[model samples]
Target: MRTKGMQRSIEDFSRALEQGYAAVYRRNFVSVTYEYMGGYIEEITGYAPEELTPEMWDSLVLHVEQKGELSGLSKEECFRMNRSGQVDRWQADMQIRTRSGQTRWVSDMSTVLRDESGDCFGTLGVLQDITERKDAEKKMADLAETLCLRNREIEADLALAREVQHALVSGQLKQFPLDVMNEKVRANFSHRYIPASTLAGDFFEILPLSEHEVGIFFCDVIGHGVRAALLTTFLRGLIEELVPQGDDPGALLGKINRSLKEVFGQSDSLLFATACYLVLDVSTGMIQFSNAGHPAPLCLQPANQVVAKLESPDQTPEPALGIVEGYAYTTQKYCLTAGEALLLYTDGVFEAYDANNEIYGEERLMAFIKQHLDLASELLMDELLHDVRCFSTSEDFEDDVCLLAVVPTAVA
Candidate 1:
C-alpha cells in the first residue's frame, strides 16, 4: 500500500503503484484502440486484448451504469498535460456491471506516453478491484434511503388519519338542531377548541333541551391521539342518546357515565373522562350545571363584570364519571341576570406550557377571566385565545383545549 512521491526512483515508484493489471490504449483517429490488454482483461471485462475498438466500447458501455460518459481517458488532454510538464497521471472510479450481471467498482490510473518528437504515442493504465468497498458504500446508501422512505409513508398515513378524525370527532355532529334551537336571539356565545395534535381527546356540543332551554357539554378523555379520539366518538353518540335527560345536567351526566362504564370500564386503559354540562333557560335567566372530575365554571357579574369561581359544592360533590358507575352526580344552579355571563373550559388551557416549561396554571386562567370580564363574550374569547397562543411555545400542544363563554341577552 506504499505510495511513492517524485523523490523515489522510477523503479521503486512503479513497484509501489502497481496494483492489478495493465493496458496500453492508443489514440487512433476518432476511436480508442487498446493495443495491449494483459491478464486482467478477461477477469475485469471478459474481453481479450486483440478485441476490436468498436466491439470493446459496445460491450463495456453496456456494463457502464452511466452509459453517456463511459470513458476513463481524454487522450488529447492527456497529451497536452504531458507536453506542459504537468502531473500526467490520472485516477478515477468507474461503475460497471460485469457479464455475470454482478456490479463491480474498479479504480483506474493512467498516464500518457510521448514519442521522441513530443507527439502523443499512447497511454498506460492499471486497474484495481474495488468491488467490496463499492458494495459497502451502496448498501449504506440504500439503507439510508429505505429509512427515509418508511418515515415519509408513516407520516403520510398519520396525516390522513388525522384529517378523518377531525371531521368525525368534534362536536359539530347534529348541528341542525343546535342552529334552530339557538333561536333565543340574545344569548351571545363564543368558544375556542384547539387540539394539541391533528386529533384531540376533547369533545363539546350544544343541545337544545327544550323550546326555551339550551345545554352545553364539554368533556375531556384521559389521553390523546387515536385512542382518545375513539373514546370521544363513543361519547358523542352517548351524548345524543342521553339528550332526553338533558333538562337536568346532573341526570344527563349520570346516564352517560353508566353507559361509558358498561362499554369501556373493563379495559386496561384509563377510560375515564372529566366533564361539565350546563343547561340555560334563556327566558328566565336560570342556568343549571353539573361537574364530574372537571373544572368549575366562572360566573361573571353584569355591571362591574366581577369574576367568581363557582366551586363544586361539598353537598353535591361527585368524582368524574366512568371511574364510579351508579354514582350520583349533583347538579348545581346559578341564576344569570340579563347582563351576566359564564365561562367554561377544559384543563388544556390552564396546563398550557411556555418555553420555560411553566404551566399556564389555573391562577393565570382565573386572572385572565377576571381581567377580560367586562368585554363581550366573543371579544373576550378572541383575546384569551390570542394570549394562550403567544404564551405557548408552539402550535403543537401537549393536550387538547376547549373554552366557551355564554352571556344572557340584555334587558329590552
Candidate 2:
C-alpha cells in the first residue's frame, strides 16, 4: 500500500492526511509547517495555533514514559516550530497547567517537516483535549472498590453470627460417665446439630458437677435467632440452678417447674420448651428421670426380644416447663443392668424428615438400635447418628435433636 502511494507522487496532501492521519486530525487540519499548529490541535488543547513552544514539545515527548497519564506525537508534524524559534516535535494528550492553574489534556500530532526530496525541515504538530473521559474512568474504579468493601463486611457479619450459634450448643454432651460400675462402664455419644440460619434454638448439655453424678438435659427453644438463643440460655441457667443434689427424679422436675413459673408467665410469644432431665447415679445403678412434654425415652436391652419405649409414669404429655406454675412433675425410677442400654433424645431426632418427607420416626429408630445392639455405647452412638443422616438425607433437623445414651458393661 505504501509503495503504490509513493509511486503516485502524493499529489494532494489532503488524500495522504485523510488516508493515513484522518483519525489524528478529525477535529481540524492544516498543511505541514514549522511555525503553526493545526486547528484541530488548538481546539482540543485550548491553546492558540502559535503558542506551542519548544519546551512544550520536549515535555510532550517525555510525557509518554510518565505512566498514570497520556502523551505522544502525530504524523502531521505541524507545530515543530513555536513563537520562541526553538525546534522539536510536539507530543499530544499531555496534561499541562495554564497560567490560571487550570489543567488541560492536549493530543499533540507534531513532528519535523520535510519536502518531497526528504530534506531536514522545522517541526509540525496537532493537539486535542481528553480530560473528561479520564476523570469518568477514575470515578468508576472508585465505586467498584467501595462495593467490594461492602461485600466483605456482609461476609464478616455472617461468620460472627454462625460462631455465636455454635457457641450456644457446642459443649453440651462433653463429659460422660466412664467409671459408672465396679468395672469401667463406657458409653459413646455423638450428635448432629444444624440450623438453617446463623444460630439454632436447640441446646444440649451434660451436667457433670461430681465424680459419680451427671445431670443431662436437651431443650429446644421456641424460635431462631438472638431472642430464641437468649431464651435457651435462660432455661439452661434455671435448670442448672434448680437441679437437686440428690438423685431424685421427682424433685428435679418440681424444682425446674417452680423456677420457670417464677421467670416467665403466659406471654403472647409462645415462650415454651420441651425438655428431659435425668440424674444418673453410677454407684447405685439407679437412673432417675423426669420428662416435661418431651419424646418417650428408649431402652435398648439386647437380651430382650424388642426395643422398649419407656412409658411416662404420667400417661399424658406433661405441660411444657414454662407454661403452668406449681404443677406436680412425676418421676420414673428405673434400673439398668450391667449390659442394658438407655437412649434419650429430643423431638428433633424422630421428627427429622427426608426429601420424600418421611419422618425418621420412633419405629425406624428402634429398629436401628436393635440392629446395632451388641456394639459398645460409643460405636452405637456413631451408627445411630449415621443412620439418622442417611434416613433424612440431610443434616437439617425439624426441631432440636439431641441423643444421650447410657450402657452398662455387664447385666447386674
Best candidate per lDDT, number?
1
lDDT against the true structure, each candidate: 0.69, 0.60
TM-score of each: 0.66, 0.56
Tens-digit per-residue lDDT, 1-412, candidate 1: 1135422443343344444343333333223565434445456666554653534543553222221122444545544553353544555566656666766676666665555675555555666667787788889999989999998997888688677655544434332224555453646666777787766888777777776688888888888877887888888888888888789988889898899899988888778889999888877778788899888888887577577866566645568879897988887887777677788888888787888988888888778878877777778877877777689856655688877777667423
Mark the regions of model 2 whose C-alpha exceeds 4 Å error after superposition: 1-196, 209-211, 243-246, 261-267, 354-356, 395-400
The per-prediction tally of clashing pairs is: 0, 26
Worst 10 residues of 2 by lDDT: 22-31
- lDDT agreement of model 2 with the native: 0.60
Cα distance off (Å), candidate 2, residue 350: 2.3
Candidate 1 least-lDDT 10 residues: 61-70
